[model samples]
Target: MSLRYFDNLLKSLYTVARMNEPAKPDWEKIAAMPEFQALLKAKRRFVVPCCIFFTIYYFSLLYLVGWHTEMVKKVVLGHLNIAYLFALSQFFMAWIIAFLYTKKSSKFDQQAAAFLDHAGFKK
Candidate 1:
């Protein structure tokens, strides 16, 4: 694709990023031997601690933001408020978690696919 098209696509994605909500997890995929459990266990080990830390961090931000919401509202950037940016930072954290998840899941998927192919389940 051309750079302009790619740029437009990226802009569209950014707009979607601002508007999009998180998805619901699939129980059927959890039920399948899709390596999600094992991968999930591995992911969970890292994620759990990170989540705890983030939960604390987030609440602390909430406290501070509440404390300084007025001051923050005054310090604006191109029509955006600090509170919205702070809230958006939380989404960025979630996005980071998701990116890590996708990378790790891709690794698990590669291994699982290889195993499945070797075991005569190639499809």
Candidate 2:
């Protein structure tokens, strides 16, 4: 019974999360070129650190939620009633991080796109 429910949940997630535009990485072209390769390396460096930061940030929230749920009274705010400022801070930080990532990724992607165009690749 639980297995069937879990399978349906996974299917629902797959359906909703399906990509509208799939990523098309040009690794072959990037690998052949020197500057494009450096751009790839720089992009990776920027991305990996941001990923790690968010990963740790979220993991700490999970840990804190588990640790603090015992002390905070769960209250209803419309639908969710998790009444805790600590939890709210986590959510706020998540939004701030998301905004930062969008800005950062745009900058990096723009730089990378320029480099790729200069390397004889189409945008």
What's the TM-score of every candidate structure? Answer: 0.43, 0.53
Which 10-residue window of candidate 2 scores lowest in summed lDDT? 78-87
Candidate 2 ranges with C-alpha deviation above 4 Å: 1-29, 67-83
| Worst window of 10 by summed lDDT in candidate 1 | 29-38
Please give, for residues 32-98, the per-residue lDDT of candidate 1 as tens digits: 5545455556667766887797798689778868787786675577888877777788888878877
TM-score of 1: 0.43
lDDT of 1: 0.72
As for candidate 2, its clashing pairs are: 75-81
lDDT tens readout by residue for model 2, 38-109: 777877887788778878877776775678765445665655555455567777887887887787778778
Error of 1 at 64 (Å): 2.0
Among these predicted structures, which one has the highest TM-score?
A: 2
